[model samples]
Target: MDRFEVLSVFFGHKTAASVVAAHSHPYWQLEIVTHGGLRCAFAGDGFALEAGDMLLVPPECEHGFVYDKPGVSWITIRFERAEDGESRWGGVIRGRPFTDRLVSSFKIAIPGSADKPYEKAFVGGFLDALLHYIRSDEFRQPADSPGALLGQITDMVLARGGRAVTVSELAEELSYTRSHLSKKFRAIAGESLKAYIDRLRVQKAEELLKYREDSISEIAADLGFGDLFSFSRFVKKHTGASPRELKGK
Candidate 1:
């Protein structure tokens, strides 16, 4: 049977100048902007998404965002294919409007966490409805070749786990010049390669700190920091908090 499993849902808010550098997930992502505006770039093309704009990204498609206004808020739902290995939907759908009634229904019906069977069923039904609406229209956007390559690069970086990866190394592995890869990545991701890596490392460190009981020193080493001081400095630079402060939270 063709079915979808809801993996996670997150409500996100970002202030002005915030950036989510290019990355892809193994599951499909549906992002709806509820407030303010942002630019979403994928497959080498950019879409200016404003309030109420919805973006449906296929699995493993490289995408990122840059907030264009203050207090940008969005709802993201991640789901994966189940049972039948084929996806029920194809291509990307952008800027579609959900009915006011549907939006209100979502607010009232959605569970805070999908721990119960009913909650899971409700979310799955919502996704089915949303996907049906998206597919009713014949809008299909083709993928950009360069954007696909950038996605591969992103995947490589994520595969490195706690190890550090340099642009030079990625370029060599991909058989492209460092300058070329850097330029293409910046154009699509709206951030430099180094900044993207630093942001990713900080994000990983935050996850480990929150979920895992690893010591700060151990976490630092896992993230490829030379020492505790360096790791603390990096965290402070990116998050404005020390590792101890974050871990305590």
Candidate 2:
């Protein structure tokens, strides 16, 4: 499997007026705005982004940035092109909750760890997933709509990094009725709120399970299941696959 072979990651915030001289390199660059805004010109096209916005710069595509606004924060991830990864992703890339959370996960990808290989694969997988979503209009739900609201819920779930969050808690946090959330979620996402979460849970569960570093019980707890039995049943019901099976065991 191709790994990201991450080169460097920089987390910085700036308020002073600054200009990043236009330049290009032989590797790839992924830049995300976590707060404030940035203006950049990429390949003759100018773009500006605020929090949750991002862009991927391909190898040797000249680009530069100007930070004029205060409280501008960003995460810059630069990596070598994988030996067996997608072609490339360039220009201004829109952001999503899941994407934001995954990018945030990079904060935990410490160097010289036993799980370095897994981390590389995780980074590569994130890029692949992002590329897939960015290519499709289907993933672009209407802004400030029900789909957008669901995005907030997704942000909460992923940010917890696998902790179980009850639907009731989500409803209360978002201050929406369960019926309304379910109704709107289904209308925009074409799936019930319960189903959407189940699917997301399964996807997260599988990712962790594949690593085999955490015990099934631990994984279950992270996914918010009370017990291994419940987690197994849910997995089987939704995917017709046991946790062990999904774990590639």
Candidate 3:
């Protein structure tokens, strides 16, 4: 019943402002732009990633981005070492040769590779390899049991994005106290549970704004916002773009 691994695939359009803004994450991120272009800054060094290009950014690297078009889609995998293990990664651990190999081997394009059935199936293979590698003693030491809690909590969030989520609710589901989950969620996700929830809600809302024809008010209500004004404020705070502007782009 313990979920300690993370494997995910995201395929859809995205905006420039959605990708930009310097931020650091606590887990590894591997991404490939299928059709559009993306510019990312990793640890002060920047590179423009385009169609067919692959990127492997280690954890804790300060990165920001700008996308060329609205049809930006990619896959990302986030994972961590076992608890009490020394394989703790932060602020950009140098990627291993195996990491580079896995990145190069993954195909994230939609209508995927012509030969692949789905982008998920293609990129999912690399994620599978990464998990196997991370579990190996040569790649990372065994971590303690307490550390696995964060991965479990994050898995829940990703599986059910902002769906009736709350600290207390998570605690009850995971059989942990609220305070413990809060602290570990922050430590592992690089943000508080509430913060991650807000980010997830906003990100989901952004996707809807880009792809759906819903009006601002409708979008707001659909995303569980109290009202248009509140949703507008939330979108502005995170992405620095109004709903209209985001939709238009």
Residue 4, candidate 2: C-alpha displacement in angstroms = 4.4
Candidate 2 regions with alpha-carbon error over 4 angstroms: 1-7, 82-87, 111-168, 171-179, 188-249
How well is each residue in 174-196 modelled by candidate 3, as lDDT tens digits?
78799987887777667888887
Better of 1 and 3 by TM-score: 1
Model 1 scores worst on lDDT over the 10 consecutive residues at 135-144
Candidate 1 local lDDT, 1-249, one digit each (tens): 237788887778886577889998888888877788889887668888877667788878889988868889888888886644436353334442233345557657763556678777777888777766554432232224655555566567777774688989989988889999899889888889889887777888888888889899998898888999988998999999999999999
Candidate lDDT (C-alpha), each: 0.75, 0.76, 0.62
The window of 10 residues in a row where model 2 has the poorest summed lDDT is 106-115
lDDT of 2 by residue, 15-60 (tens): 7989998899999898889889999989988899888889889899
Inter-residue clash pairs, candidate 2: none
Total clashing residue pairs per candidate? 0, 0, 4
lDDT of 1 at 154: 57
Q: Provide the TM-score for each candidate, comma-separated.
A: 0.49, 0.59, 0.41
| Candidates ranked, most accurate by lDDT first | 2, 1, 3
Q: Which stretches of candidate 3 lie over 4 Å from their true place?
A: 1-148, 162-164
